[model samples]
Target: MLSGIENAINSVFKPISDAVSGFVFAEVTVFGVTFPWIVAWLVVAAAAFTVYFGFVQFRAFRLATQIARGQFTRPDEPGEISHFQALSSALSGTVGLGNIAGVGVAVTIGGAGATFWMIICGLLGMCTKFVECTLGVKYREVHADGTVSGGPMHYLRRGIAERFPTAGGRTLGKVLAAGAAVMILFFGIAGGNMFQANQSFAQLRNVTGGDDGFLGGDGAALIFGIVLAVFVGLVIVGGIKSIGAVTSKLVPTMGIVYVVACLIVIGTNITSVPAAFGEILSGAFAPEGVAGGAIGALIVGFQRAAFSNEAGLGSAPIAHSAVRTKHPITEGYVALLEPFVDTVIVCTMTALTVIIAKTQFWTDAKATVAAGGPTPDGVTVTSESFASALPWFPYVLTVAVVLFAVSTIITWGYYGQKAWTYLFGKSMLSERLYHVVFCLFVVVGSVLTLGSVLDFADAVLFLLALFNIIGLYLLAPVVKREMTNYRRRRREGEVVRVK
Candidate 1:
């Protein structure tokens, strides 16, 4: 019955998925290495932002840390959440399966060399986050009820109009903003909610004996989905404040736990550390037997980094916009830390663990790919790597995966709700209806394969970067002006420090 349902859904959606995928992932060959044009688009934008901002990721790294720690935050700020909470909310959205499974996929396809490129892409992406998030705060709407709504929709519409201040500018802003909102809502359901739910269920089922356990029963997934949705609904019903509070605690605890687990795996194989680093560095430049050679690795790395940290996608700005800060650029500075933590630190740790563990999963995955077989499941490969060290670690990984999924779902719930309100009126009925529909999709995602559905969602997600990056470029000057003023104020002791 579940298989039939999945097939029916796929039948209805496959054509739509194929069309969007073709357009969004159109490939272009550069120097005989073919890769998605969208990946290059995102990388180019990040690179441009990095250069345009004078490497703000480096110059303001310490300042970002200070501001995120609440050192420069005032209690009377208008936004709903503190700097740390806002960062945590944003981090929870990005630092999920992408860090664990996605890294495994990267190394399997692109070799260990991909890890090097992932780090580099993540570093460059910091500036993109800085730019977009600055404008998110700058153009956000603070409602009479004190709720904040922002992201690419707000920035694209309002920032663009403010920049041009003409009828044409306003029309362009509205069109771009509408496109962004629609894409956000679509991806929030498909990628953020459904994909996470499906993967989390897969991980749970695997850990529970892979079709032999009680959870492998026909109705188990439905039950799991409902329970998950209930938890998410609880948090999201309270809106961003509730999400901020939960994520502020949950993100740090989960991150520290995951990082420590990775450290243990690496520490147990301490002798292999130097050799693993050597493989990463060497493979990055001259990978043997890998497709597209170094360029292949670079493409894979950039793709994974873009997918994992999502710096240019403009989703994080929504969460960051809720930060309680008078100076919008402070949140931008805090935002830069997101890609660093998600891709640079967490993802790098996962990659290092997989490399140091030296599991047979890699060899088998590579062989399967060479034979034109479907890519091996990333979660499985990652689980095998952890289990190679601690035989019981897969259970821990299950917990991590589920937590990651729930956190991602709730953050995206807020994102989608904001988009829904943007499109429809923000009445209580509309908000509740959106939440109900969102949760239903969570159940649907858990019960179904969602093959083409996921592809469609991913395509829409990248499509968001199209509208968002264009808006970012148009508003880059605004961000720079804000940054200049903030820096000048700080230097003149006009910005207060509480911590």
Candidate 2:
């Protein structure tokens, strides 16, 4: 019966998913390698935003850190969470599985050179996050109950309408906003919720023997999912405040633990570090004769970096929108740090660790994979890299993976909730029902394949960029105007330094 339901779900969605996937993942050959044009679209937007803002990512980074520390924020600000909490919650979403498995894949397939392009993408993505998040806070809605809601859905509608009042105005904005909401709503459930549950359980099962551990028997995944769901349900019931409080601590703890463990592995083989950097730089621009070649490396690096940080995916804005601040740009300033921390720092660590690991472990694994042998997945490669040096680090990795997955799940729950409210009315009953369904997906995600769901989830998220980028383009002038006024006020001593 369960298998039937899973198949049925796939059957219904597969056709639509296939069509969407084709368009979304359409390849354009560059540097003698084919990559999804969507990657190019996102990178172009990041570059454009960075140049338009006069490299605000570099100049405003210090101010961003200050805002995150509450230095420039008034105590009596009118929003749901603090700037720091908002950053934490948003980071929890981006700094999860992508930082681990995704980085490993990029290095393993794209080769060492991919790391160079990855850093470049990370730097540019910071500007993209700044633009969307600033608008997220600027156009948010505060309900009568003191709860605030925002994101691409709000800004695309409110911001776009303000810009094009004489040219179909709100009607056009509503169309784009509605489209983005529906896509993000689905993305939240599949990519955000189910995907997290799936990976977290997979990692747990890896540590504990399959069908041998306490909860590893038949229906183990389902049972584990139920318990996990209950835990997540408990935290999410209180809304953003609840999620924020948990993620604020959880993100920092998980990050420190992972980074420290990575350092231990890297530090053990400290002498190889310089050589690894050399390989990365040379690999990035290798001649066509090289494996994956220059283009392949660049494509791999940019795509992985984009996926890891999710700078312009428009999801972070939802979390940043809830920050307590009189100045929306303050949150924007703080948000620019997300890509740097996620990709530039965390991802770089993962890539270096993988690149520097002894090839002794991959001799047989790569052989098996070369000749119609069983596929050795990237996650396995990552595990082998850690085990090569520390020998006992897999246990530590299991804990980090679970924590990263959990943190992302909870943050995404908030994102999905807001998107849900955008489509369905924001009623108490409506919210409770959404929560119940979300928890149920936690269970479903653990037990099912649902490949179509993954495809659809990925496709729909790019649609977020479609609507979001359009809205950002329309509102760019408004943001520029406000920025000018803010600068003038600061120069005139009208803006106080709360710190």
Candidate 3:
């Protein structure tokens, strides 16, 4: 029955996925090497924003840290969550399998040199996150009930009209805003919700003994999905406050454990550290077997960083906009650290672990790709790397994977609810209905293989950048002005400092 449902859905959605993929992942050749135009689009935007902000990520790093630690917090703030909670919630969404599996894929295709480019891209992406998150708070709507609604949808509609104030501007704002909302809702259901649920179940099954485990029975997936959904529904029912509170605790604990695990692996192979760094540097510039040489490594690195950190995807701003602060720029300052923590720190740990351990999985994966075969499973490769040292770490990796997926699902639940309310009007009935439907899809995702459905979702997720980056470009000046005002006020001691 599940297989039949999967086939039916795939048949219905395959054509749509093909069409959307063609547009979203369109390729362009540069200097005889081809890469997705969307990757180039995001990379260019990040670079432009980095220059426009005069490298604010570096200059304001201390200020961002201060704000996140509640140094500048006041008793009476407008938003629902603290800056740290908001940042943690956003990080929970972005720092999932991408940091683990995605990095494995990058190093496999682009070699160890890709890690260098990934770090560089992560740095540039910080400014793009700053600009969009600032605008999110600036244009957000705080309802009578104290709930916040924001993101590209709110900013594109409100910011564009405020800046241009013409019929053309109003029309453009409405169109773009609707497009963003639809994209968010679609991706939230498929990629954010279903993909996480599906992957979590897969990891559980793998650790329990693969196809011979207790969770490998016919009804096992359904039971697992129901249990997972129930846990997720409990947290999300309380909305952003609940999500923020849980993620504030969960993200830090999980992040510390994961990072510590990576450190242990790296420490065990301390002798290989210098050689791994050499391989990373050499593979980046003058690789022997990697495709398209240096340019290929750069493209793969940038793509992985963009997808993992989601710096320009406009989703993080939704969570960041809920931060409690009088000065919107404070949250923006806090927002820049997300890409750093995600791509720079977590992802680099994964890459270095695989490289330092001299894991054969990635080497075999590279050979397979070079021979025009299917890319190997990234999660499998990453797991193999960790297990090479610890021998019993696959169980730990499975636990981490499940926790990461649940955190992502919880955050995205908030994101999709906001988008649903934006389109269908904010009523109790509407919100509850969305939640019910979302949980049902969680069950469906676990039971069935949604091939084209996931493909369509992935494409729509990137399509969000099309609407979001345009709005970010238009509202860059507003963010700059806000930064200037905040700095001047700080200089005069006008901004309150609780600590």
Candidate 4:
């Protein structure tokens, strides 16, 4: 009966999934390598923003760190959460299963060389984060109660209009913003809620011994989904404040634990460290690992980085906008840390662990692709790597996965709610309905297969990026002006750095 339901659902959604996947995964051959256009577009955007901002990600790195540490924060700032809280909240959304599973997938498909490119993507994406988040805070609406509403919708609609003064231009800006919101709504549910639920549950099932584990039986998913929904539903209600408070703690806890565990495992296998890195470097530059090997790695790296940090997706800005800071640019600076922590640091760590533990596992993706098989599940690859080192590590990973899923679902609920309110007014009914649908999808995701869900969400993410990048291009001058004035104010001693 369950199999019948799963098949029916797939049959119904297959067409829609196929249509979306066409655009999301549309590939173009470059230098004898085929890759999705979305990956190239995002990588180009990241590099462009990095250059346009005068390498703000590098030059302001120190200041950004100081600000995130609350050096520039005041108790009575304009928003609901501290910069650290905001950063953690956003990081909570981005640094979830993707780091564990997605990184493995990238390295698997692209070879060890993909790890090198993934780092580059993260560095370039820092500027992308700065741009979108600066616009998010700059154009955010502060309510009577001191709440904030911002992100691409607020900036694209309002800032884009200012950039394009003509009536038609203004109309186009609103349309683009609305289009992005529509996509955001779907992605928030699919990727943020369901995918996390499904993947996290799968990880749980794995660590528990799969078919024979007490909680790993056929009906375990529904139970896992309900538990996730209950915990997440409680926190998402208080908006960014509630979510921020939870994430500020949760992000650090999980991050420290994961890092420490990886460190121990890597330490246990210290002999292979140099050789693993050698494989990474060689795979990156050598062209014989797989078909279009170096190029394949490059594509996988960029694609995974974008998926992991979501710098260009314009989602982080929503959470960053809620940060309490007198200087809007502070949060932008703080947000630069998002891609770094999510993609640069956490993801790199995961890759290192996997590469070190199971040497032969590095070729899984290339081998699979070369054989015309589907991309393997990253969770399995990552779990096996950890298990190889410490027989008990999968249990730790399972706990981390569940925690990551819970945090992601809660944060995404806010994102979807914000998007929903952007299109429909923030009435009680609208908010409640969005919550209900979001929770329902969490359950659905846990029970269903991921092929269709992933394709649909991936498409939605890229479509929203299209709308968002259009606005970013139009509003680039404004971001420049804001950054200039902000820097000048700091130089002239007009803006005091709060201790």
Candidate 5:
């Protein structure tokens, strides 16, 4: 039965896969550079919002830290998880492959310049996170079972029903919520679950050479699937507190360790750092100008950064919405840190490592080409860079990538499950069914070609953002109202209230 099911999925997805390949080659280009459309637009648009919001990502920095530290958390808050855990769970999702593999891709294609753009995107993405998360908490519903089910869908429907009484207004809200839920399911399954598993297995296989039967090649993915299923099942079955407990510990420890490693590599080749920055600044606008004029250089840099940070994808809000706090704005402030950690900090480390590796070992020309090539083997490239800089770097990076990928897969599984339950209803049986299917796909992703599925998933994520941003714009006043209220209370030293 399992073999037959795999065959059926393969046959069904083949045509979709072919069609995506065709699209990637045909439509995505800027001066013969096959750039990713969804990523490109998302970066540009997110930058614009950051600008329009007066660079809130920058302004909100200190406050975000305060909220994360529990300094601002009151004793009488009403929510499922704390601010710290929300950040961790969300960070788990954002910080996984994009930090390791995605950064490698950026440095390869965009040269060091892509790192700069990624920072810009991440910085701007904080504002986007703030808006959606605020709305998520503001309009969330606590079911009789004491579980929370809220996101763009709840906010759109509740916010609209409350504010916009017109028939068309109500209809639009429902449509947008349904659309976001569906997109989340599609994106969560493909990009969040399968993609992570595929990359993790590929890297593990590359290193271990498939020596163990069930742990070899695709078998590694299967084993990974089962392990991941057990861990996630254990945590998610216990609800938010369990997920929060794991992330609270995992996120900070892993995050800080990865950053410190990159700093060592950067310090070793300190001189090249300036030249790397110079290259990034010039190539961001005119890649050809600095790297002898290859449009792919700019596209590669931008696409990798955008993919890693996910500033405008609207997926982060789902995780952020779960944060426990009375003030929605406080959580928004915390959400701002997403891009800083994911893109600016983590991605910077990867790029610096890559850049320094090139200076120390590879030729200028080869490094340049590797920087812009597709399938640049970022994980390997990063490991090579570290090994050159540090004695035991490969082992460390391999472990980091594995952990990062595993945590990421589990987080995405939850996201997809939420989307599934939102659309199909809160059936325990259906949730179990999705858990099994999602786990099974992890193994499949390890063995199969996912380029097409990745493209489709990315498109779905971007589509969610497109719809989500619309709702955000319409409900901007509500965000402002909450922000103002939070500030007023903070100034007055009143007990923080949910209202």
Candidate 6:
């Protein structure tokens, strides 16, 4: 009865969600597309942090590798999971549909140039990841019951309590924390779960053609819901350990498979590699390649890149916060690796596959589609490019996409569960119920027309970034202070011990 009611309520909100999305797009369009500006500002912020952090992401890269490799898996750390598990969990959240379909969208819309910008964003974003995640660990709180609950909220509240004794500071911290919690919840359901499931279904439907025929759309969603609900139940019930075990194995395997496939496609057309890059760099500035097409290439580029790495959107720290570490900056250093893996490496491979395939065989008619009409190929644009280079690629990509989508769903289930526990109390009942609900949505996400839902969810995610970045700025001094303390301990031959 409770689950039914929740589903009804979610259904009821559909119209409101559509209206909000319509309004948001309309408003965004009026300001001459603020997305470009949003992207630019985030790029600048990330860049500035990189400079200020003394290139810590670079300097600490080797140490991070060692940590991830289990060199520091001491049994006495004040956290729940290992460094590898934390990285896997975070990577699962990111290495999803965004890398697959998002890259295709970036290339189609932004021409080649968006790939260049995506790379830039990934490189600089490492610094932003380092700073924010360090704060997450530094200010994380241990509960009376010995459980850990942390993220921007704990840090925001504690940091404000200490640094700004004024009531205004307290109020602002509360407001930001509240806002971030809501955003995280919304993002968890919409982008993390629904968007992924929806795109997976869309791709499947396309691959199967209409022969597989969806149950009436609602019915189709219901079927998806039932299957995912069961699977999510099986994993999440075991909590972080189960989630970690699955993702640790899944993320790296799927990532390598996808990369290898892309390399195969790119190698087939190795001659076009230079031209593909040249086009990307040039197209980014002028967007000439997508100018005559229906959709603006520039819009495609930035949106895809933004969606892929989630740099400014600030959803990653929540996952990173779970790492078992005494030095907050250690997790931060690991966090920096996400965008590099997601955008610069994986996304770049997908983009290259598309461009190289396009250059070799696709016709002009296959290239152009006016703005209102569908793009010449749509999501399979990248796959088509691959198929052009390697005949068996479509099947290989199908497996890769399935792995990406499933791993993403499992990881995001934990994110939503955490947010649910935050909003409601951390009752066992609440945790179980949240998992059930989240899994059901996965099916709904798979079968539904979730394009608008994804957009709305993404918007909420940005709201999170807004709150987090503000808190990050406010607490910047604390982060620096901790770093100095860490460095001092190390330099003094104090042993700087951590379990």
Q: Top TM-score: which candidate number?
A: 3
**Which pairs of residues collide in candidate 5?**
108-371, 108-372, 109-371, 109-372, 110-301, 113-280, 288-293
Report the Cα RMSD per candidate: 1.3, 2.0, 1.0, 1.9, 3.7, 4.1
lDDT per residue (tens digit) for residues 243-307 in model 2? 89999999999899888877887898899999999988988999741235677788889999988
lDDT of each: 0.91, 0.86, 0.91, 0.85, 0.72, 0.71
Please write out the lDDT profile of model 1 over residues 362-427, one tens digit for every residue: 888877775677778888788888888889888898899889988999999999999999999798
Candidate 5 per-residue C-alpha lDDT over 1-499 given as tens digits, one digit per residue, 9 for 90 to 100: 5456656766776677667545433347566566656666666666665766677777778878878888878655777788888889888888876777677666655556666667666666677777777888888776677667667878877787677889999998899888988888887778877777777766666566556643573355567666655665676666666777887888888888888898888898899888878766766666353333445455565566666766666677677777777677887888878878887788877877877667443344345565664344556667777888797877677777777877777677777877888888887798888877776776667666566567777666767766777787788778788878877887897843232
TM per candidate comes to: 0.98, 0.95, 0.99, 0.95, 0.87, 0.87
TM-score of candidate 1 relative to the true fold: 0.98
lDDT (Cα, tens digit) per residue for candidate 4, span 34-141: 788888888899999989989999999999999999987778878899889999999988888889989878777777888998999999999999999999999998
Rank by TM-score, highest first.
3, 1, 2, 4, 5, 6
lDDT of 3 by residue, 1-499 (tens): 7788889999999999999999999999887889999998999999999999999999999999999999998858899999999999999999989999999898888888899999999999999999999998999999999999989899999999999999999999999999999999999999999999999998899889888999888899999899988988889889899999999999998899899999999999999999999988887897464765688789899999999998888899999999888788999999999999999999999999999987777787888888888877888888899998899988998889989999999998999998999999998899999999998888888887798999999999999999999988988999999999999998999986789
Model 5 residue 409 CA deviation (Å) reads 1.8
Q: Write model 6 residue lDDT over 1-499, tens digit each, in one string.
A: 5456546656766676677555433333434444444555566677777887787778877766776765654667777777788888888888877787777766765566667777766787877777777887787766575556677776777777779989998898888877878888888887877777766665565556444556434365567567766876798787777888888898999888888888888887888888988877776676245542212454565456666777755566767777777778778767778777887898888888887788432334235532434554444677777778677777778777777877777777777776778779788789878877787787767655555456677666665667777787778777777778767766896534343
Stretches of candidate 2 exceeding 4 Å from the true structure: 30-33, 289-291, 361-376
- Candidate 6 vs. truth: CA RMSD? 4.1
Model 4 ranges off by over 4 Å: 216-219, 359-374
Poorest lDDT segment (10 consecutive residues) of candidate 2: 363-372
